[model samples]
Target: MKKSIKNLFYFCLPLLIIYVGLEIFLHSLDYEPKTKNEYLEKNKNNLEILILGASQTERAINPEFLDFNSINLAASSQGIYPNFCLFKYFAPKLPKLKIVVLGMPFNAPNTPKEYTSPIVNHLNLAFYNVNTFGRATMPQDYLLFHSNQDYFSSRIQNYFRDGNYSNLNKFGYDTTRFYGAYQAANYNIGKINKSEIHIENEHNSKAIHNNARYLKKIIRSCKERNIKVVLYSSPTHFLYNEMRDTNLVYERDSLVKNLMEEYENLYFFNDEDNSGFEADLFYNANHLNPIGAKKASSNLKTFISKIIDNPKSF
Candidate 1:
């Protein structure tokens, strides 16, 4: 019995040591948590404007381009449910948070959208609240890592690499852009998963219900805090919509407009038909490159300045 106990200790000791070492290293490194963690630790105190969305907003909106003190909390592949959780997490900490600019992609209103990347989904899943990512709306990202070892290993290796903050300005804008790359042929309309599309079609009411719930949660949270919430759709190249379903875009805009009417604090900027995008302005079909981002940012600042100047109009 004593020999067995000694063997067990030897087996567990290295694992325990490795765990501790990893924890210490994670604290020291600028990995997945670094950007958001930095905002919480350093910028929360003085910030008035906060941006949230998927990668498009991360790349498009330069906080420096805006006149207000701002930070972009958008992450790649993040959805609205995660945005709500992030608001809940940060609202208490940021006493001065006055305005929240949330990116609403055309597909954002569609319910039960499958998370594209396991790593991104898992990272955001860490912020999941049972109330937000309930059984019906949320995909089981936790189970994905078990089936996809390569992706799981890649996620870990990415942590050890020096984070790509080169494109990221201090205000959390990712300045990376596909300059002069007219690669429209490479861009395609976002495809719906056949299986999930079937499921959504069958349970149409459930998808709509969850969509309303998540969107309202974000608006309500910000309303409670007296923070103005902007439902912003950043510009894309005219080719961006070439492959998309116009009916679907119309529905999303209608829903957003209805919500804006319902909530006094909520504002919507569709920008669907407003066009000035040349081939050089786009990184791909769905996102603007640096040149486009600059022009879009200038226009946004003008719009926001007017709104901020006349708070009563909203």
Candidate 2:
């Protein structure tokens, strides 16, 4: 009996140690909380526009050009769940906020198998600490919280390599340094292939419906507060537009149009248009480089001004 008890203890010890270590490491990389807290401290009740979404918003929108005080709270691959969580956390604190711009792209995957939901983190839970995720309960909240497998590993490496938390700028935008031009293959200096960038049959109704639930929740929340919601698809390379338009695969585009029809306060921008951007402005098929971002921001400023002036015009 004594020997069996000792054997069981020995077997469980290493796993216990690893589990504890992982928990500690994840908490250490809670850089989002720190970045958010700092932004709140500086701009609490001062933000007029709050940008939320994945990486596109982080790289594309510069709050400096906007007519009102603004902050970008977007992160790379952060997705709609995080967007909802972050908005829930900051919306109440922002007394002057008039608009919430969500960077929901055309190709945002919606299938359950595509990615896990309740992608909440310990830091986010500690701050936002909500019991529910839109219409669903987030079971992962009580289980274990890591941003994602890849992000978790990257954060661990970054922690050991001098604690690099440079992703968030003072304005709450990710101003990661990039240089040189985007490399394109089999295209002229000014032309890009549409087939390479178009995402057809990549999403089904289930996936779109799942994401749309949270989007509707956000819209309702904003509506209750009398704030407008702008759902914008950031610029993709011209190839996406040319290919999708020519091939006539409008699954993603159709879903967005339907959503626009459903909600009066929810607006869509540049959903099917890429004429506003040149191929050289993109870093890859989906994201824009700095020059492209500047042009997008300027156009957005004009659109926002018009929206602010004529609420029912769209």
Candidate 3:
């Protein structure tokens, strides 16, 4: 029996060593969270603006286009709860932070935790030591390779195959362009998954309310510091926009409006309906490509300036 146990341990030792080596190798590479982590660690005190939300705002705003010292902490599949948690953790570190721009995607107010992938949570823990999972995190939570084997495998494979480290730019923006069919029939076909359906079900009352509470918490946090809060919705393809449920979207807009009326430092920039981004500008039906991001970033810059320049004019 002892010999059998010893043989099993010996056989698994090499596999364990290989896994540890891969984890170290993955950590050494640059990624969105890794890049953002390093930058904030070095320059958080000088930061004047911080952008948080999911992919929509992540792809829309480019810190390079802004005049202020800014950082984009947004990532794809980032939930409102995680956004609130991140802001709560970093707000004190940013002495010069004057504005917080939150991208209000259709699902922002009711984004489910299930919608937030294990990889998103893993990256948050691995890079920032943040527990976006809303519980006491374990050691494995901070592991890039152990958190999600599929994600780690793909990342490692892609890294070796193409010598690529990340899909994000220096400011954590995804610059990948949309190259697939963009018609109404093909709009976000594969991207629309269980999360989308779960959010639209209208039966998730608890999650919806919790999301609102977290959002208000973020707004209040900024207001207490005399920092401005901008809850903006970037442009979505008209076809994708047209498919949204009127009631759900209106509820989200109403919540934002009410919050604006309730808070002195809150502002809402309604580009979701007004900004018409052409097909060439979209990386997907819901996200903008590099060129579109540049244009959007410029417009956002102007918006921020106008509001800050004359607070009452907005």
Candidate 4:
């Protein structure tokens, strides 16, 4: 029995080492979808503007719509943590960075603590230990022992099946749908019943507190580096506005207003005041369609221009 156990352990040790080494190698490489390095390589020193947030910002700002070179580093379901990581990575690279537009969603404040990307953590670790061969061992352990092997196998199988992993550019910007603005519009905000508004508000408030802390840190860091930070909320459909009215208008507005007052460099663009825009402009209650994104971008450009022209007025 002792000899059998020893043989089994010896057999598995080689497989364990190989798995860990592969995971570490993949982690060290700049391979994560929509990561900062990927964007930096494409945009480089030409990036005049940086847009950060979740999917809302991803879909809202199209670099083709503007004269300046812009890149959206937003990811789906990403909260302040990844945004902070992105800022830390890109801020130093962008010497000519003129503007940073942050899409401050209502849900940003409510992101759960465990919402970080496991993939991102691996990337960070690998990057941090780039010179050493053993740096990737940790991620390898995670892949071998902690992560779901079946899910990982499925991912690998699908990657080859769909040919997605073979094409790195597929994970890059999407020009057809304007980098996911069309998809954001498809997010259904009307599903929330009137009764659920209050519950969502209460939950969202807790998120807001978490959001506020991270936002404050981001703002402070930007200010220290002389980088301008614009805090803007994208236009939500009428139903979303109604939901906000039902539960979060006063609290949210007050929180934003206080931040604006505290930071002389911060600006807020609230779209709820305009009620005359066509409903077709919106894809849903929480996000704008392609046309709406264009309009919003135009308005933001004009707003930023005005701020540049008259710094004190902003």
RMSD of each: 5.8, 4.6, 3.6, 5.9
| lDDT (Cα, 0-100) at 250 in candidate 4 | 60
TM-score of each: 0.75, 0.72, 0.89, 0.69
Candidate 1 positional error at 106, Å = 1.1
- 81-135 per-residue lDDT for model 1 (tens digits): 6666677776677789888888887766663534434455554543332222333
Off by over 4 Å in 4: 9-36, 115-158, 165-171, 176-200, 204-210, 272-284, 288-295
The TM-score measured for candidate 1 stands at 0.75
Clashing pairs in 4: 59-181, 109-207, 109-208, 110-207, 237-285
Better of 1 and 3 by TM-score: 3
lDDT of each: 0.64, 0.66, 0.79, 0.60
Q: Which 10 consecutive residues of model 1 have the lowest summed lDDT?
A: 192-201
**Model 2: per-residue lDDT, tens digit, 33-56?**
456566766887788888887766
Per-residue error for 240 in candidate 2, Å, reads 3.1
lDDT at position 111, candidate 1: 39
> Cα deviation of 66 in candidate 2 (Å)?
3.2
RMSD of 2: 4.6
Query: In candidate 3, what are the lDDT values of residues 189-297, reduced to their tens digit?
Result: 5544323332232435567788889878988888889999998888877756776777678778888888888998999886776555776677666777778888888
> Which segments of candidate 3 are over 4 A away from where they belong?
165-168, 176-203
Model 2 local distance difference test score = 0.66
